[model samples]
Target chain A: MNPAVPTWAGVAASAALVLLAVAVAWHGRLRLARDIAIAATRAGVQLAAVGAVLLLVFQHTGLVGASGWLALMVLVAGQVAARRARGLPRALPIATAAIAAGAAATLGALLALGVIAAQARVVIPVGGMVVSGAMQATALVLIRLRDEARTARPAIEARLSLGLPATDAFAPYLRTTLRTALIPAVDSTKTVGLISLPGAMTGLILAGVDPFTAIRYQIVVMYMLLAAAALASLTAGRLAEHALFDDAHRLRPLTTEPRRERV
Target chain B: MAPDELFALDQVTVRRGRAVLLDEVTCRLSAGVCTALMGPSGAGKSTLLRLLNRLEEPTAGQVRLHGRPLADGDVLALRRRVGLVGQQPVLLTDHVPDELRVGRPDLAEGQARTLLEQVGLPAAMLTRQTAGLSGGEAQRLCLARALAVGPEVLLLDEPTSALDAASAKAVEQTVRRLVAAGLTVILASHNIAQARRIADEVLVLRAGRPVAHGAAADIDYLKEES
Candidate 1:
């Protein structure tokens, strides 16, 4: 083999991806373009750092390092969820609780079923997918819950005065609000196969895996995602209810709290 | 016991965010009588009524219903007996009269229809979607809803503020009828004519405090302002 294709091919591919990202950024406003440029640079550096570490860790350390990688994924996921809901005072705890409950439960079930083995290579990627899905669900549910509580406060108070218990009085609105938040996950689940084959399934097939094996993996992943999304949304919804109401059952002003400014 | 002394407030004071929304606001609402609150904007007119219902907790005073202290244990029980209506009448997006009456399975279909008629709404409107009801019709529906709970004291908070002249007159007539039927009505409004026409007593609030409160006909200050 005259000269095996340069190991730098991976770097060259990433550089090309960066160029395309910059071109897209150029079409936006200057502020957005600057943000995009900074984000792309950060992402590239972080990925490269992880890639180097992974190369050494996988070669030397065994299963223990792999567990570290899985835990790292969860930590990153929690941070992203918190960042997304930074404006809400109750976001951090709600986000972490949601992501942890959702990812762990769904992932545990899948691993036990042998859909994904206990191997870190398989476990980490699937867990990352499930956790990220939960994070998005948590963010959406919290935003909707906060907004609906404010907009419909009068109605809630009216129901309360009608001799309905606080929770029962809020049940109608909570149902509507939670259902609205879950619509995205519901829609995605409904349109999954017909709209497009997901990346993991497509990639597995491209790598010479049998069609039936790819289909099995895709089905398992999709169901786990739905499971994760539902759990996260429900947990976030419950937390939001607590955060919005005081111990006396009076509504707390969601907008009154001073939010920390992003750096 | 006379219905005239149905509800009483003993030096109720409430603070909201460093502002004294109600200070030493003592008043009594009589059964089968219409009491109107008259004051300029930002006067504690609305806040005073909210206190009677225990919707807002008092900072340094107590509210008594039927001569008993209003406390956490009695709040829900009292609230069920008190019907409070606000300016913008809100109805849930779904549900017609039937759904609202589910808990009180004893509520007859005829009673629901009669409620609509009492509020001057067509019985046909009850079957219609709440989304399609006009401001006037919806206010009437809200009144009907409040009546469904069988309240003894009706707290009216600018109940006609969002209605047209015709709708306002309709709602006022409804209130008049309710008052005639032995319900204690506490009406909060800024309109002098409204107070004079229906109120046996008047309470004026200013700067989160009651500046003037007494019989409507005897208050010369209202004449000066109106």
Candidate 2:
């Protein structure tokens, strides 16, 4: 089923919304107008490129092409997450593993249960959602773990001096970061239908599907996102914890360590 | 090289970014002796104490504990034998008993009370929260927590600097008792008089360099300051 086509005029009209945002930022002296403009331009260009690629894959590729698309998305998502996880060693690899694990667990369960169709059109969109959610959770977990590890260095060292293993010494901070990382997912999920119509449900309804049917899909999406977030946050938090401490069970301060600062 | 040598820092050096916190300094701290690390603010007293417990690894050289390389054995076990009370009191848990049980979770109430008493805190302190403690009380609590693990060597980083005169004296007495009982102490202090009183040996550091290290009484600067 085809949705209403947007002409260039319509695209320009929609792009004008970014100017409004830029105007407000300029008025407030927020110094974000340039960033906002750049981000909007990048988003438009990237989405256009992704759309062209997806169309090509849909026409000429099978399950392999679809899987390749998902893998590519996972890698890109990992890089995005790693950008936010400054001062963490092996952040790129760790983020990739976490995002991959979360996405696999989420999509695997849905696929096994026959909840989502195995078509490329279905898998790519659902995988994108799962990977995006996982990326966000992973990045949040890493950032929180890094910041809390620095601030709580004294307490962590105190635990280490007590002869506690590195994992045991870092357990409290890991728990805190995990909880903090999962907060957004939990809050948004709880308030989904009440506060806002999430992207999936909006898309489904706009695709001429029944509202009640769209509601079913939205619930599944919410559940999958929750699962992805928990899995990703735990993986990233645990991995980052291991990175922060040495074999001597002593804390190596994240910022102080001679690491390549992501500037 | 003596059989009684507890911690031997063979040219141990620590650098943070562009600053050299501890220069090439070789010193052997004997077992069952109280060794004070005396220095000015940035003279690396804390850095030296941390080295003994293997808290901060040196940028260069080696640290040998009990005649073995510090990295030879399990670090957790090493830390248990060599405990550390940092400059500030950072009790793991809010309550006294729980804080004591942080590393040793199987700690009994009686044992907790005994550790408290050993640190000059009353047994009644077991019921108190760490949040309400005074500077001296908190430092003593940190000491009690360290003692709870039954460490052979205790590292104290300015353990009494934050306390008032009376509280400092109380901590000093506790240290004397521990030393008499054959516990090794590597203390970091700015107070020269305090060092002379408590330390059997003193290693004077000036700008991270070892200026002098000998028996506390024989150290001319320490004697002169006294």
Candidate 3:
């Protein structure tokens, strides 16, 4: 079955599956019928638009066009991550920069080493994965850092009043924040094939690629995500550490920001 | 600029939103002076002490150190010279010695031992973990940690309110000894008797206003003037 372009019959079957999910939620009284229906509708519409755009992009695939697409992905991801740490100084720019750096570093290494091609088709899919992984890591790091700064105020202030520089006082908490952000990525990588065939490998196999070759690509993707996550966490954590302090070497009082709802 | 003055708060006012944390406070403390800040909770005792080291800057006023406004001096250097010991025993590191060696990474065991001894903690405490310490022991450790930086002036907030009688006495004696050696100390305490024992001068606040400033012996000499 060609998963990329589904037949009318195939589309109907998928639509039925969505209805089943909605029905199940309604039966269980999970109060998620509207949520499930809304999510499915959004996914369907978004994927359709992306598919059409990708077709045009692949037709005129060039270095410039591919780069533009990647930039857009990073910008969107950064904005999403920034929302997780809204009250922080330069939150939007910092989030975008960290995610971009992580994705670029990982993808650059992969292309240079001949693990992935530089074509728009190859770069976009793999780059999307890399960017998404980095965004998750960065958002988690920022949120955790803010929380730790609040909870550990007394401990940090003690160090500050003892004449320790802001960087030195905040160093331990930064390490803890990075560790918390990286753990999920590391755990997923560790349990990859043991738990289940991952998304990339499963898609490749279902699309008629050799299972062995698909596994090889999936392995590279796993390593790519790990590298991206670590890079993003490091960049975001250090930038955040600097943001937390004032020129007077005192911790800036972090004001609470309202939570925003996203579609 | 009085030659004897160590700290001068000139028309200082600190406001948090609509709440006044400190209101038009103006005072002077001489070098080698041990001044106790006494008042009930929310009396701005801690807020007044924080100004000595710029832990909390006043919104509308000036805090001068050695005739030089704190705003003009190198803040990092100023902090090194003016240390602080918070009301709570805050030990950042898991072990006792690491907490003392926060900024002074190269501090030797002998130096750590001396600081612990000065704060009435045993030398063995230097090698011990901070997790096992009692409230009084932790308080002394915090004192030793502050002294590790060799500050010229120390700000202590409710320092001995949590300690036992003997431990409190030892801490009070340390404050007196340090003052005798020419260091200035500003302590925030609710205990009137403690203030009388160690403070050479006392500043009593009521709801963020300095109601009285005089000799420690005259702690009971305050009369509310309408």
lDDT of 3 by residue, B164-218 (tens): 8987887888888888878889899888778778889988898988888878766
Tell me the deviation in Å of residue B189 in model 3: 2.8
> Where does candidate 1 clash, by residue pair?
none
* Better model by DockQ: candidate 1 vs candidate 3: 3
Clashes in candidate 2: how many?
0
Give a tens-digit lDDT track for model 2, residues B104-153. Answer: 88999989988888888899988898899888888888888898888999
The regions of model 2 sitting more than 4 angstroms off are: A1-9, A12-42, A256-263, B1-3, B15-19, B224-226
Clashing pairs in 3: none
* Candidate 1 lDDT over residue span A69-130, tens digit each: 76777677777776765555577777788788888889889878777777656766787788
For model 3, residues A122-155, the per-residue Cα lDDT tens digits are 8999999999999999999988888888889888
From the highest lDDT down, the ranking of the candidates is: 2, 3, 1
lDDT of 3 at B184: 87
- After superposition, the stretches of candidate 3 with alpha carbons farther than 4 Å from their true spots are A1-6, A112-114, A257-263, B17-19, B162-170, B219-226
Q: Pick by lDDT: which candidate is best?
A: 2
